[model samples]
Target: MALAATVAGAPVHAQDSDWLSYRDAYRGMVAFEKYGKPKQFLQQHYQVGARDGSPLPVDFRLALSGKTMQLNLPLDAVGRAVFPLLKAAYDENAVLTVNRKLGAYVFRPRISIVVRPDGVYEGAELRAACEQALDFQRTVNAAGYRDKHCVGVRFTFAKKPDADVRWKGGAPLPAVPGPAFPDEAGNAYSVVTVRFDAATDKGQVVSQNAPLAVSPVFE
Candidate 1:
């Protein structure tokens, strides 16, 4: 909640130079789609953020526009959107636009472990999922992720008072205010982080409420 500022304080405007070419974005997204690796537990999304890597405003959006195509892209809590690979938009040379000044925002791909519908996860499964994500990053040439280890996972919940997350048959985990994904700039959410050290790696994490997303914590 505190991590994001409302758009009401920031004027939303359109600048020609701020638009991103759809063709270029398509190529970047296709690379992940074509990657052949052990990534069943991982997922990829197109994320929009400020050029300066600052936190995104609440209700932020990225739109796809062209001569004959117009669609609004909805963003998750972390400014990630499910990028649509539309052939029609590509043929029309559509551009991705946002309501911000020139050079204020950028778009990039984000990969993370998938969230389960049941809101329950095995510690070992989470570690394996993180490994899959890390391996995918290395193969894609993300030098920053190469040497890091999966130390934990972060569960981001909605801004509600009853967001409960804890270890199974145990007390609730400590809730902190932070971004859903590490290094992501956006509005803050209620987060419960679980570390995978020896004492804490054998139990199942249970979430009484569904989380918006679950991100791996690498260190």
Candidate 2:
């Protein structure tokens, strides 16, 4: 509960100018499609535990910019969250006793990219960057065990190319429609992609490769 309470107080980082439009597009997508309701009980009340029957309480926060979703979890809190979740999912009387061992909870988020304008997009680069960030967080948390605090977090993105090229000064870009992804409970999430074009001084479209689609990955 403290974790959830603290999340609202967490300072959000300044969003990138180039990526701001994408964020709006993502919001629009959520509005048009029904992603259903989030598992408020699980997120707010569940506690992770270890096989030894030790309890873990992890605090988590999330943010989206461009095609990336950054997940922040305090080290101690993450350790707490993972253990309990694992305990509930696994058998307590099993010979292996998988829950006894302590390990890092790695969060790797990914996005599907669709480019409509037909240009070479650095999909691999984006994927790699997200993976690296997730890996690094795992490492940091592991190393900080001496302090009894480890923050296990993940960053992932799904990218899609946008074809909507109309953008007037101070106006939001148009939204592109798309299918929805269902969660563990079979609820659908409506995802939309919004594209912005880089233009020259004379208003000539320079590149369609600008960053597209920004929204909460797990909302």
For all predicted structures, in order, the TM-scores are: 0.81, 0.19
What's the C-alpha lDDT at position 196 in model 2? 20
Alpha carbon RMSD to native, model 2: 20.1
Native-to-model Cα distance after best TM-score fit, residue 165 in candidate 1, in Å:
1.8
Off by over 4 Å in 1: 1-16, 50-59, 160-162, 185-187, 199-201
- Worst ten in a row by lDDT for model 2: 1-10
Give candidate 2 misplaced runs (Cα > 4 Å).
Answer: 1-120, 140-186, 191-219
lDDT of 2 by residue, 148-172 (tens): 3212111111223333232223242
Superposed by TM-score, candidate 1 places the C-alpha of residue 202 at a distance from the truth, in angstroms, of 3.5
Tens-digit lDDT track for model 1 on 1-219? 011211111212223476777776776677678878777887878876665545677757689999988899889866788989899999999988777654566556777778888888887888888887777666665665668888888887776464687788989888877666776555457778888878565878888877877877888
Angstrom error of the Cα, residue 125, model 2: value is 0.9
